[model samples]
Target: MIQGDSVTETHQGILKLRVSSLIALLFVAAAASAGCSEKMGSAFAPSAVEGVVGGGQLQFHDADTTSTATQGIASGGKKARWDALPESEKAARKARMAQRKARWDALPESEKAARKARMAQRKSRWDALSESEKATKRAARKQRKARWDALSESEKAAKRAERKTRVRIAK
Candidate 1:
């Protein structure tokens, strides 16, 4: 009977030690996880060098990107910095842009055909609308314009961004 009593006491002491060890391990793990999370936070945080400083203000700046990373900014030549560009170079760019615009303005047959089809479709849709439906649409447009005019600048910016995102996704 005395031996049996000693065995029970030993089991209880073993259980207590196991529980205590588990608790200590949990605490250590929690502390380690917290330290790791803090380190990760700092790692992802933006550094001071990632922005432009002007008038004691820091503005975030993104690096310029080209479609072909290996290619230079123009015809495998280094891009001239915008602020430091020579007047002659600027004039040449402007002339090139004007030439491109002129070429675009000379419409191709395919574009003309597409434009005609679009106009025809728009006319047909307009003809299909009842007078009451047209009135309703006009009222809706006025309401939308009023609502847009009432928006704050920041809200308008957000709305424009949302519209651009929608257009991109649609394309």
Candidate 2:
């Protein structure tokens, strides 16, 4: 009878051990699945990965670092090195930029489209010009620049005023 009881106690112990091991395995599986969910970018939680992810590039953005958009490379063509420009050129460039911004703001979508189309047409025509024609245009441009450079400061100011007046009238 004692032997029979001992056998029954051993069987119960084995059963308990199996249950504990199964519970441990289930917990391990759950923890592993949680890791997988993190990698998959679960909607319930924010993704661990940051920055722009596309085009086979993995950029990691940190709090102190500026975004690629602000650096002006991937978003569009490279920006001009503003710090390298002469002070005289910088003011003129700034004024021209402001004027362009104002003009762009004032234009309706249709007008903007028309302007873009006109620019495209002009570019196509320029591209179609023969090599000799291109050279002639370049020579004419150089001559105009030389003539402008030869003018006195007063003459240059007059020319600028005249150009401004012409532009205002055209607008």
Candidate 3:
């Protein structure tokens, strides 16, 4: 089961444990029933667990070193990865993954997709305008700004008063 390099400080930060040590420890404990799940991921032999850490009880934990076999490529996609696997298992796993991805994609987005409806509405306004109509509208907008700027001082004060009365600022 120990398929890679020995555990070191950097690897420890990454959650790798020695499976060979675990297997050795299990053997020393006479736990023949303690079968190593070729997949359960360990580097220490079962017997090695009792080697001398603290000179007492054995230490065991979930190992995290990913094996070379977990390359994410579906080897023989239609075939079972494990001989014991049922025929339907592969299809079912694929179906589940597809569903998971769909759900993830469907999830509301914080920065993008969630506001799609709002964005589409805004885009629709832009999309509906003809090129010449848009140019005319831009000219009209500029004229409106210029007209507002040309207002007399009294006209500006009146407009500001009207705006103040119409707009209720929330606390």
Candidate 4:
């Protein structure tokens, strides 16, 4: 009975080891791909500039980018779906990314550092906007609403009537 139990235990341990190795390989693949994405974008990289920006530089204002990174405006912005590409296309995408990276590298170090710092500060300020500031804005909004609500009934009626007339004329 002891020998039978020992044999089963060894078999299960080997099976566990194989599963762990497979999982480890998957993780390694994921990590390698993540690194590639920063440097090369995906196999379907639509914009070369984005791939370059995804790394350390943070490109936003370049003429060809999908959007102003700060304003969150993009020309082709299908933010949900990223991957799904053919291999030949992936090679082409990688070439495009290299070009973008080369252009970015040509800038003077001082300029590069300055731009990086400026963008960092901008991000910091955007992030650091306080709850107190938010509350103040809220209070201001409420004050405006309250003032609007305080209008005399006759004034409100006149505005509503004017709006209705304008709508009718526009239509």
Candidate 5:
């Protein structure tokens, strides 16, 4: 009877040990999965150290150092760069605009008339707006312009590159 009691005690101890080990293993697995989730989330997050240029070049900026990426870039702004382009490039751009205009010209007369009517309706709606409403809209536009002006040239280039890529992908 004493040996049977001892055997039962030993069995209970082994069962307890197994349960504790299983609980520890489960905790470790949960922590590992949480770590993996964090890594996966960060993989999709935007990187703060790198930017995309207009030419799709990766420009790295160190937080501890000043960025020299825009040093050699033209600094007269977008219009100035357009003005600096060669006549051939200007002509090509003009040709692209002309092509767009040609497409509009080729549209059916009814479609054009409908578009004109829509534009007139839009103008009428704007005209119907109260002075205070117009002022609010103008203020919003100014705020947007100021915010845009506050961005660095590299940031602007990155935004343009991203927009172009998105447009290309959408098309």
Candidate 6:
């Protein structure tokens, strides 16, 4: 009777050890699968540079310098930048814009009319908003832009990947 009791205790101990080892192995496997470089918080966060012209290449400038640059562009007009570009670059840009315009022109008349109507409706709605409401909307836009600018490259990639996945699933 004493020998049987001892055997049972030893078996139970081994079973407990196996269970502990299995749990630890599972934890290690899960961590490995999650990738070492990804931060949990940023995995699904939106990128800070979504609509920027050069994407991740955006440069920061002091307020005065930025305003001056903006003023230069605005005052000089968009034509100035076009004039500064090399002839070959200008030709390529012109070709691209022409292609886009051609595509727009090729759209069905009803579709074009619908788009125009939608734009007019949107403009009317915006115009109807109170000054404070417009200010709030602008502030929200700025906050989103700031948040998008704050994301790291890896986080941005994660967000893009998530967006692609969502789009694919929706389709």
What RMSD, rounded to one decimal, does every model reach? 30.8, 27.3, 28.6, 25.9, 30.3, 29.6
lDDT-superior candidate, 4 or 5: 5
| CA deviation > 4 Å runs, candidate 1 | 1-108, 167-171
For each candidate in the order shown, give its overall lDDT on alpha carbons. Answer: 0.57, 0.61, 0.57, 0.57, 0.61, 0.59
Q: Write the per-residue lDDT of candidate 5 for residues 1-171, one digit (tens) a residue.
A: 347435576777878767755654564455455553323532222222122222222222233332222322532245577898999999999999999999999998899999899889888988799868987998999999999899999999999899887844320
Candidate 2 residue 39 C-alpha distance from true site, Å? 50
What candidate 5 gets wrong by more than 4 Å, as runs, is 1-93, 148-171
lDDT minimum window of 10 residues, candidate 3: 65-74
Off by over 4 Å in 6: 1-96, 152-171
Worst 10 residues of 4 by lDDT: 51-60
Q: Would you list the clashing residue pairs of candidate 6? A: 48-148, 48-149
Q: For residue 154, give model 6's deviation from the true position in Å.
A: 6.1
User: Tens-digit lDDT track for model 4 on 1-171?
Assistant: 246435576777878767755654564455455553423643322222222212211222233444322112322343322345666777898899999899888998788998899889877875588857756877899998898799999988998889888844421
Model 2: per-residue Cα lDDT over 40-122, one tens digit each: 64322222222222222222233333223311134212234566678998899999999999999899879999989989988
Q: Estimate each model's TM-score.
A: 0.34, 0.45, 0.26, 0.28, 0.35, 0.40
Deviation in Å, model 6, residue 41 alpha carbon: 43
Candidate 4 lDDT (Cα, 0 to 1): 0.57
Query: What's the lDDT of the predicted structure labeled candidate 3?
Result: 0.57
**lDDT tens digits by residue: candidate 3, 111-144:** 3564576678878997699868877988999999
| Deviation from native of the Cα of residue 106 in model 3, angstroms | 28
lDDT at 102 for candidate 5? Answer: 100
Which digits, one per residue and each the tens of the lDDT, describe model 6 over residues 1-171? 246435576777878767755654554445446542223432222222222222222122332332111211342235567678999998999899999999998998899998899889899999799868987998999999899899999998999889887844320
